[model samples]
Target: MAKGLLCSAMQMTWRWFSPDRTVTPRRQLRFPAYTPNAVSLALKSISKKTKCLPFGLRQPDRPLLLGGHSLDIVHCHQYLGVWFDSRLTFATHVHYIRERAATRIAALKALSHSNLGALYSVLQTFYSYAIHSIVDYRAVCLVEVLESLRLSLEVLQNTVLRVMLGAPPWMRLVNLRAESGFPSLQHRIWERTTAVIAQLCRHWPRFTVSVLLQRTLDRPPNPHPGGDWILLAADIVRKLDATNAICGGPDLPDPAYAPAPPWLPPLIRCVEPTTAVPRSSFPAVLCQDSLSHVAALSTPDAAVYYTDGSVSDDGSAGAAFVCDEWVESWRVTSSVSDYQTELVAILGTLRHADRHFYRCIIIHTDSLSSVCGLQTQRYTDNKYLTAIIAVAASITGQGGEVILHWLPGHVGIAGNERAEADARHAATFPVPTFQLHPSLSLLLRRVAYTVRHLSWEDHQFQIYEGSRSATWYAIETAYAPVTVPHGTSNYLLVSLRHLRLGFPCCGQMTNSNPEPCPHCFDISEQPLLHYVLDCPATSRLRCGISEQLHNRDEPFIWQQRLLHRHLPL
Candidate 1:
């Protein structure tokens, strides 16, 4: 009678099964041969055989083994049917626990001390295994389970870090229980708690989750707290949101062009920031040459570096400068308002820097105009000049100084060759001139001269109009366009106009500039075909040009022929 009652109670409590390992109704009569231990063992096996239930196991609409459900193996005196998924794997473990409980009770009756340790180990193994087996469940429940496992393992805490030291190491109790540590064990636990909540908050932004994070953060680190990992996670999330907002969202006020600040890492624990050593171009820095001479000059007295510029009537200029550490003052000389001379002198000084104490010296320039422009005191009018100024500023900004001196010109001075070479080179460059209302004859002559001079093997010229210029088959890349913008065009044309001639415009090539007209040397109305085929005057000029040419009797072709006839000049 007692056996039958035990079976019935087990069936009512957990829907127990029998040999077939399935859920079914229990028998009314007690089996005379069966013991409670045998029945319990059968139940354990049956639980293990069951399949896990789906996620909807808690819903009444999805129950599988209850109600009128019955087993197919009823005749074998065993219960058998499809078991609920919840009872699949975990049910067997639970049954194992119950079986152990009975065994432990029996051992206690025999006064066995070893049984206590065995039971503890069994519980520890079960907890660890069960936690690992669970998947995609509630994080809150997982945290609670972890807390329970921690409390249960308190008595054997010393056994943890010992076995796990180098392999999947666990936190040592000694490390966590440190005295006067900024971050204690308690602090670490609390931070980890917040981290878990924050991670979950990413998927589920519930009010409860936020509250949990706040609570965890409010609590200080335990005895072994190190870095605020949770705060780092939170800050990362915030930055992500901020970045998204700045890209397009309405919440961000800044433009996408503005740079963002450096990210504060969550794991940094008061380590010093690192700085890179700057690379020096001087041979001493790279070759590790002895700096004994230079090093001695570094004292407060230092040296003076002088620079000078000059311009001559022969269309040349010169500059000279010297740096002397003994004097502590620069000796500089150069002409004022001269660009080429000053630039050449500057290059010369840079090349012969080893001749003086350039490392510890003050620079001096005679041209106040050039010095002021170089030193940002004056406005820069040319892009190339601006680039030079920028380079000088960068160099001087690094603890060097450049002083200006107004030296008088016309003195037969030294260092004039460099300035003369620069001026001569600048003058050697072909100046551009264009015709305003130019005659067709004069235009054709000029075009012929330009094409032959600019062309490499192929005789051609790039016509310029407004801000645009086109290169027509140059013999080499050495050829550069000779044109200026409308504003600068006036300057080049001034002398040509005085001589009653035309000059090319020196405008920058812009997308809006009109294409050049090949026939009339104008982009607005003279395309290449029109110049070669349509121009009446051009056609009259070249009656018998190349026979293979498409435009045989065309005025533009005639013009091209006439232009070519004067190529030698």
Candidate 2:
């Protein structure tokens, strides 16, 4: 009687709700196991043996009975597209995503290793389409699952990078990253999730999810805390630039774009910022070495040390000390300046000599400041300089003399050239640990740049009309760890900044004003977009730039083409 009544009631409601349409009771009903006849048919279509009741909710003492059918009881089941279990641990789901992404990566290994030049775009597309989706699906919620598996995920990403770049697995992490042009897995996750949160706040003005985020953030980090999400969001806001995302004071008024002050990470502050190192105080003897001198000095008991430091375009720094007996490199923190790296290298070389019991030291370097500092500033207030000066004074104590030689860099002076190579290798090889602290302002500026570009990218201003500029792309995308030609990059940077700030392209818009373009008249303000894309005056010049581009033939491509016109074919 209960079975008959339930079926009759369901049929009546189904019919009433679908008066004009065909209501297939078998197709639409969720718990169709109520009908055993239909269950056999449904079981035949699906590969599963049985299905579980809903988990994580209260259950009744009585068994579910409908249409005289008996459904098996289980602990885990798929409901409404997501899997649910008795525990709700989400371990199964995390394992699935990992396996799925790894499988997709394996499928692309052949294409990744292929010599397909232009088809590399295809490989990237495949990654974006097949693998990134698997990795990024529901990432905001699954951040903890991903974070715990970060080392494994990084290996997966590195595997792809090695295959894509045609590099061996033993290649340095820095080199693989530079070749593949991908940030770390952790960084990508942060950027993606935060950007999504930023997008959500923009699109949905009144989402209650902000309240959940706020409550989670208000609490502290605990093993059983709200989740890893709180820690993740707090990490981005604290270490990365959280305050600038939204308007107002400390406790952000709008919780959407603005993340509140993180509870986990203590605010970053430098106790004592690095000061300028004074030049050495002692009078230094300069070594004027010819080919013959170099040859003679490359013999026994001669303690000649080569020191060099390198700063790349992206602001990464490295210092190297090379001698027949000792060689190693130190990666400098981003906050450290190029000049400081040079001094640090020289200082390190002096310390190395002191440790080895070498009574006499001969140094060859390309840094003028390194040579000058030791040559004159013996009694200086600077702490780093004072130590270096003491090292200089001590070396000459027991049959010890110091020869500070200036070698022309990269002109085949064997020792100096080796030091330079080692410096570059150090900069581009291992990841920097940032053990040396630089000034607070420099770190703040770097954080600001990251926030601005990320906001810019999230805003996707590039797609808007008349916003495309070579300078913007070159600055935002190519500026990180990628070297741009110095002169051209500078011109592009200045042109773009000027154009955005309403500085006139010609004479009319600024204090250093020029006459307006003859064709556009004084009514129109001349900006970078105007000259590159719209201005009739530069049409011929723009046409010539377009013609020079071999790979691209569009109007917008002209902007970047002209920007990089100085690049070699």
Q: lDDT tens string, model 2, 1-569?
A: 00101122112211123222222223323444445786767632221333334333344344433333433445554443244454455566656666777778777876654323324445668877787666665556455653455667768777776655555544444434433456656666665566555443333425665544444445654455344465566556444653333211111121212221345221111111112322232212112333444555454666878888888887778888898857978887654666567766777887788778786577767776656554442323123445565565556545565666655555566677788888877777567733444422333445546755554453344335333333344333343332334454333433432332223243332446455545675434445445455667655555655454333334234435445554211
Which 10 consecutive positions of candidate 1 have the poorest summed lDDT?
265-274
> What residue pairs clash in candidate 2, if any at all?
280-373, 280-377, 280-378, 281-377, 281-378, 282-378, 507-514
| Whole-model lDDT per candidate | 0.32, 0.51
Please provide TM-scores, in order, for all candidate models, with all chains considered together: 0.18, 0.34
The sequence of per-residue lDDT tens digits that candidate 1 reaches over residues 387-497 is: 344433443545444333322222322222233333334433344111012112222233334333323222121223221112211111113322223333222322221
Model 1 accuracy (lDDT, Cα): 0.32
